[model samples]
Target chain A: MILDVDFHSGVPIYRQIVRQVQRLILSGILGEGHQMESVRDLSGRLKVNPMTISKAYSILESEGLLQRRRGIGLFVAPLAESRKASQSKALFDALLSDVAAAAVQMDVDLPQIISGLTEHYQKIHSQKEK
Target chain B: MILDVDFHSGVPIYRQIVRQVQRLILSGILGEGHQMESVRDLSGRLKVNPMTISKAYSILESEGLLQRRRGIGLFVAPLAESRKASQSKALFDALLSDVAAAAVQMDVDLPQIISGLTEHYQKIHSQKEK
Candidate 1:
């Protein structure tokens, strides 16, 4: 639902939109069966071209994460939530490797990273409770 | 030095190459002042276009992570390792937000995520020790 696009990122605008939509769906912010913004409306709101938004929607549909009805707009697919678990795991593994590799390079030892992560987790958890 | 390109990914080949090189630098596998593989050689090895490899190297140079000698080959910048601290923090933050969002969406509680991370950390730490 919160889609912010940086046009200067060198990444294609349509691709950014597609990834953001996928993220929203995976995050449960856009749950299963949730309708997506109409291409024209989203394009207007985001100040992007309708074709770009439509391109993103078409890709998501092809991925089976979004479904379209004849007269209705696009919506999240029923199986998207279930599929997200594995997707999230893969993403998490990639990020962890990235961070761990950096820490090792910087001589930030494993115990330090573990302690840092533990502290970060507690902080986020406490804030969520509040 | 390990660069694996997934042609099927929506991400461009050049961009993936750039990220992998950056990751290698951050991990200290490619240390400061370390020369990189020649464009022709790397392209041949990866079975990718030389232009694509050149594009990645050019972007990295612009980012101040790579240096090109007039007659010699490309080398990792002297300051790249020091500069990577801030870069890694930003990357870590982005990844944390992504994972946290997914967990929240799935109704996976913070404590569960914390425990999972702790377990993962310990496992990786033990493996490294071995």
Candidate 2:
């Protein structure tokens, strides 16, 4: 998985790293029991501080997405992959509420957002199927 | 608008305030040139420190969503109401990309998400149309 960091995006670097790792894990690119790169290695590769990399790793670990073995490296949690579906569902619901509220405020009918989602869903599906 | 703060949500209080305020502004509940409640008043009402409220206001002001008048108070920016549409679109696009990436990893069909969105959109539309 590629780690791309946008230093000027206004989002904190540690958060950017955390999000990228989450995306990689959720996408199955990093499966359960997969050992993660050492904080030193990742920091070197990403040109970020080792402390920042460990901060991201520690947060993910605290969230139960990763686990560290004593005197060993961190690995993906066994349940992490299975949890993605529910996690994504929760994310969808929360974002949907916000979007729906904004749509109502803009005088945009729900049909428009539905249609927009349908279009994007189809586009993504077709590309993936190919 | 009522301000509800959750003290144990794990999210920073200042960020929660910012998101709530943004939602209000985006939903048109707060319009251009609308004078916001004084920071002291909001802090008192929300039972939060005045510094936290000021921090949220300062961030929003830096983002050009609010304007500070000398010796007066912060008011919604003239362009904020107009900017919501574009901001919402950008938000939708970014979230859609993340959702799509996760969906592909899960092997969930596009039809599933589209159908789910259709149901939600209809539900919201019918209630709003009542």
Candidate 3:
């Protein structure tokens, strides 16, 4: 999976890999039980140190997003719905508060944000043909 | 805004913050223009290094999710729909591929992942009431 990083940004490389990958998993784009790039492979692809990739994978594993097998490669964890809910709720709280503040600052009403989000959500649904 | 780190897990702390927060914004739980806690405040709250918080915020800001306002603390950037679309798409690509691979590996079919994701997506939509 691609880490999707903007290397020019001040954010460190390793964290970028972690964040982008995590985003993929949580968004339902990465389904349960997938194999991520081997750390060595990703390191080669990103031209970064293996430690960096290893670090990212380790994080995903700990979040229960990735599972490790003795001889097999690192694979996506299976069915993380229940595991992610609590953590996701806390993250959402911060995000919602931030967005609310931004909307207020921009003189945009809450309804506007809600509408835009609803539109996007519907778009995703329709695109998925669900 | 909390970083939502799992210190015991293998992922680095700052990266955890970035991923979780990013998820919040994308999920519509965090609306546009939201104000995250100042780096100093967050650093203090999490008892982590100022550098860590700074690093995470810098990534978000670069992604156009957060804006650095001089002396006003780091505020959430204004709505960034156009900019985020490209970046978010790439992240989702990796996520979907991973999930698909995982489903195949687990002897599960695409239908299962799609169904689960669909069910969860529906739950989110209904909860939002839109």
Instruction: Place model 1 in a CAPRI quality band.
Output: acceptable
TM-score on alpha carbons, each prediction: 0.69, 0.66, 0.44
Angstrom error of the Cα, residue B103, model 2: value is 4.3
In order, the candidates keep a fraction of the true contacts of 0.12, 0.19, 0.00
Q: Candidate 2 regions off by >4 Å?
A: A59-72, A80-109, A115-130, B2-6, B9-12, B59-64, B67-74, B80-88, B91-109, B114-130
For A1-130, candidate 2 gives per-residue lDDT tens digits of 5676888876789998887787667656788999999999999998999999999999999988899997899999877434786875665555455555445544456566666666776687787678
Number of the candidate with higher TM-score, 1 or 2:
1
Global lDDT of each model?
A: 0.73, 0.74, 0.62
Per-prediction tally of clashes: 0, 0, 15
TM-score of chain A of 2: 0.72
lDDT of candidate model 2 versus the reference:
0.74
Return the clash pairs for model 2, or none: none
> By summed lDDT, which 10 consecutive residues of candidate 1 chain B come out lowest?
B98-107
- Among the numbered candidates, top lDDT falls to 2
Q: 1 or 3, which is superior by lDDT?
A: 1
The residue-by-residue lDDT of candidate 3 on A17-68, one tens digit each, is: 7666765666556777787778888899888889988988888888777889
Tell me the alpha-carbon RMSD of every candidate. Answer: 4.5, 4.7, 10.6
